[model samples]
Target chain A: MGDQLIFTYIVDGDDFTRAGEASSSVKNKLKMLGVDSDVIRKVAIAMYEGEINMVIHADGGTITVSVSDDDITMVLSDSGPGIPDIEKAMQEGYSTAKEEVRSLGFGAGMGLPNMKRFTDEMNIDTVIGQGTTITMKVYL
Target chain B: MTIGEIQRVLDAQFLYGEELSDLDADFVFSADMMSDVLAYGEKCSILMTGLCNSQVVRTAEMLDIVCIIFVRGKMPDANMLSLAMSKGIAILATKHFMFTACGILYEHGLRGGA
Candidate 1:
């Protein structure tokens, strides 16, 4: 992975309006790198969902994306209250996001599921009070 | 249908990307929830939603949705318009409710994406 391109961004939780900037940036970079349109789309959607989740629930986070010849890896780490039950959270309609978040057109409980759906591999690591980190890889 | 045709059918107003009016959409997906859009939106699709936020534009950008129809007379704010402009995503605001807008498009033969 010596030639891998790693891009990291600090998601600002204070501005819900700016949540997707990082994901958008990555999509542009992938496009410039001549990644396949379909693969670029999957990475964009997955990372966008993760970015939104961090803004809504985690009050902010760090997203690190690395692009290599074979795949693109995204690590979303947040300091928000960790998910209580991974199984429950994985359910399609289960969400802890506030009503305010729902009013913003999200919190449909599909974030995690959609992320998992778009990526080739996904793993969630969390502790009740500590934080959560979701690592997802999309094969090119 | 082209974004121009859809706009004409719905009598919608263009908030951005008017230059892309001639662009054709392969299909349409209507939903207010960004999650559903992310999960199911397809390429070259037009999104119809009552949600008016930057996220709507962001979601459409992620899914490669070519146009966004803000149904129910919902108008996007400056933040959303700026984002859409940057992404080159067309924005149409229709006074028609979501159901009616979708109905009109479906009746006119704009099926959902494959």
Candidate 2:
């Protein structure tokens, strides 16, 4: 809580190529702050996947990362169409990304699975018509 | 194997990070999909792909991948190269196909991610 760094980002939906900028920025800041390399990597990978999901699926979102002594906590909230089936989406090699997204070297059906792989904990909150929120944490 | 050796085996052009050509790497994974790379690649490795974009470089940065070799003679745009320089990740280019590039590196002792 006290003296912990709380970084927030608003991911822009329009620019597909710019999707990972926020995650990259956070990675650099964490490096400067001297977080452990392994912890930094896990956090970066999870954040990157979530950011890409925001761009490709959510149409945009806000991510808040709170860095403290014990763990790195991330909360990602998006306003796009919510996932109809969380279980299906959680399956590896399952994706709904369009062909164009696949052409861009993504939409590989690996995003959610990879996020789950890197984080110590994950939670999904969604509404059919509204949006979804994902909370993840990686213990440092 | 050093990145320079991987470049030589693939007949690659060191588009950036010539200073790091001597940096060592032990393996590679060829995929345009950053997700796959993130899920598969390991430390002291290189990523070979035809995808030309800033995210590729950013992904390499996040993974701490020492080198990225763009195959099929593709060149990343200015933004990507700039980001690569900022991140200190080596960038290379070659006319070899992804399969061929991975093979060459494997021929030179670099294997796929375990």
Candidate 3:
């Protein structure tokens, strides 16, 4: 593989049906690159959860995944209403999603915690009324 | 057990991947929330859920779940079916509710993953 390979995807918030497209694409790409299955699974799940969060709360976002020999890094950025309380949002069962989202089998307040649980490292940067950016990494 | 046996056990109808009936999975996870599935579903090869949507299939694909059993007679739309087909993930539908379907699978030796 190259020293570093990067891929970016634009997530459309209006379409709930298409939320995990980017993560799926990345997973296939990593598979073709011969990345470890466990690593690929971790990246896919973390990014998929981030993708769902972007759709449900951020209204839309851009996800950039970079693959290298040592680790894989994913950055999810959004320009919607930012997370007001990172601490609360990080809780396992604290959620601000509506009933509609719950009806779709999501919004159980597990997105951020699951993201953190799956990845080796996760960082969140947010500003109230502005936007949020989440960066995650998984070591190979 | 093989997916075929699981189908017979739960009286499920295959919506896709009927050819994969020979596939075997020892562990099964049941949940409606995709996040919970993502969090703890890695060790399980079969996912049983009441949620019917494209994201469910997408979640299965990410987790490499061999099959998804939609309980309570919930049906997945064409787009979801095609997506699951393309990913080589089997889809099953049963009239049994989540509790009963899971119980049947458990009784048949499909244990939950740690």
The clash count for each model shown is: 0, 0, 0
Whole-model lDDT per candidate? 0.91, 0.88, 0.94
List native contact recovery per candidate, as a fraction of 1.
Answer: 0.89, 0.75, 0.84
Ranking by TM-score: 3, 1, 2
Per-residue lDDT for A59-94 in model 1, tens only?
999999999889999999999999999999999989
Question: Where does model 2 sit among the CAPRI classes?
Answer: high
Q: Which 10 consecutive positions of candidate 1 chain B have the poorest summed lDDT? A: B36-45
Per-residue C-alpha lDDT of model 2 across residues B47-106, encoded as one tens digit per residue: 888998888987888898889999999998888888899889999999998887777777
Weakest 10 consecutive residues of candidate 1 chain A by summed lDDT:
A1-10
- Categorize the docking of model 3: high
lDDT value, candidate 2, whole model: 0.88
Error of 1 at A76 (Å): 0.8
- Chain A accuracy as TM-score for every candidate: 0.97, 0.97, 0.98
Candidate 3, B1-114: lDDT as tens digits:
999999998999999989999999999999998888988899999999999989999999999999999999999999999999899999999999998998998898889875
Residue ranges of candidate 1 with Cα displaced over 4 Å: none
Candidate that would win on TM-score: 3
